[model samples]
Structures are given as C-alpha cells and as structure tokens.
Target: MSAKPLTAREAYQVLRDIALGVRTMRRLGEKPLTGVYSGMMSV
Candidate 1:
C-alpha cells in the first residue's frame, strides 16, 4: 500500500473535512457511521 505524506496543515485540513463530513452524516441519520465516529472519538 502506498501512502502519501501530508504536511501538518494539509493533515489538519483533511481531519477538519472528515469531522464536518461525520457531523453531517450524523445529522442526516447515518446511524452506523455516526456510531463509528463517536466510538473512535472516545478512544
């Protein structure tokens, strides 16, 4: 597997995007993904 290394700012932006996506999914009633995100965040 090939992984691209992101700069700190780039990584932060990616994380922010993911956070927004998860929040939106949660608001839209995506229970499975919302549970996954909540579980991961608690860790």
Candidate 2:
C-alpha cells in the first residue's frame, strides 16, 4: 500500500527537526572531548 503524503506544514516541520538534529550533532562533534580525557590521564 502507498503512504499518504504530508501536508506542507508537516513537511516543513520534518525538515526543521532534521536541521536541528544535524546542528546538534555538529556542535557535539566539534567539542574536543577526547583531548580533555587525554589531558586528565596525563595529569
């Protein structure tokens, strides 16, 4: 069976959610958490 299509608003909301998730992942990945751990181990 074919799925129903989303309305314009639904499509916009889905795009917005996807953009937000990508931004969050980018921000988290930008942080150098591994370096912090290495520094802690050396001290």
List per-prediction Cα lDDT, in the order shown: 0.53, 0.51
Best by lDDT: 1
Candidate 2 regions exceeding 4 Å error are: 22-43
Query: Between which residue pairs do clashes occur in model 2?
Result: none
Cand. 2 Cα-lDDT: 0.51
Model 1, span 20-42: residue lDDT tens: 87433224333455453455321
Off by over 4 Å in 1: 1-3, 22-43
Q: Quick one: best TM-score, which candidate? A: 2
Q: Where does candidate 1 clash, by residue pair?
A: none
For candidate 2, the C-alpha RMSD (Å) to the true structure equals 14.3
What CA RMSD would you report for each candidate? 7.4, 14.3
lDDT of 2 at 37: 42
**RMSD score of candidate 1 (Å):** 7.4
Residues 1-43 of candidate 2 have per-residue lDDT tens digits of 5558788997677668768774232222334665534432210
Backbone clashes under 3 angstroms, per model? 0, 0
